[model samples]
Target: MGLFSRKKEIMVGNICPKCNMEFSEPQRTLRHIEKAHKSKKKFECNSCG
Candidate 1:
């Protein structure tokens, strides 16, 4: 793509009002807010750490 030829921003769902994070699905966006911003860490790895 050229410099002037920009890509389009597709909105599959709503953007997060709190952090301005874009998500394709509404459920996924909600989950992201809860996990990342709401201090709900539920998907931690034991071997990776």
Candidate 2:
């Protein structure tokens, strides 16, 4: 019945390897690692003639 539909709750079991944080979705966990744990590298351009 559309009137009495129950949504299943997802359990959070995904853990971040860097921070050990729990996330419900895998995507959120990956995002957290990229933002907090992983460091961003800057690229430098050199011109040679």
Candidate 3:
């Protein structure tokens, strides 16, 4: 292994483009999405806009 190298993923939670909500784990957020919210819209970065 070296610097600036790709690593294995842990299947973390999905990123909300609309809001800056980040989840360290997916299970918690997945449940929240399934229960609290139904469908979510994708958002893009304003800076990248």
Candidate 4:
């Protein structure tokens, strides 16, 4: 028996410019960009110290 299920999954929404990451909410996409791409970490952990 050969039967194919007709199930389709589609993603249509905001996408990050820097990283092709998809987000359902536009706000989330913006936040992701600001946090991951735009913002810079001030402190860093050193193993020697």
Pick the TM-score winner.
4
1-49 in candidate 2: lDDT tens per residue? 5898786554334898767889888878867776787575465457731
Candidates by lDDT, descending order: 4, 1, 2, 3
- How far in Å is the alpha carbon of 42 misplaced in model 1? 10
For residues 4-49, what per-residue lDDT tens digits would candidate 1 score against the true structure?
9865643436688778889878878867766777755667799986
True lDDT of residue 44, candidate 1: 77
Clashes of 2: 0
Per-residue lDDT tens digits for candidate 3, residues 1-49, read 4888885554545654335467666776555555556576477688986
Q: After superposition, how far is residue 23 of candidate 1 from its true place, in Å?
A: 0.5
Cα deviation of 46, candidate 4, in Å: 5.6
**Which stretches of model 2 miss by more than 4 angstroms?**
1-13, 40-49
Q: Estimate each model's TM-score.
A: 0.47, 0.49, 0.32, 0.53
How large an RMSD does model 1 have?
A: 10.0
lDDT over C-alpha atoms for residue 43 of model 1: 79
Q: Where is model 4 more than 4 Å wrong at Cα?
A: 1-13, 45-49
Q: Evaluated with lDDT, which candidate comes out highest?
A: 4
- Considering lDDT, which of the candidate structures 1 and 3 is the better prediction for this target? 1
Q: Which stretches of candidate 3 lie over 4 Å from their true place?
A: 1-20, 39-49
Error of 4 at 31 (Å): 0.9
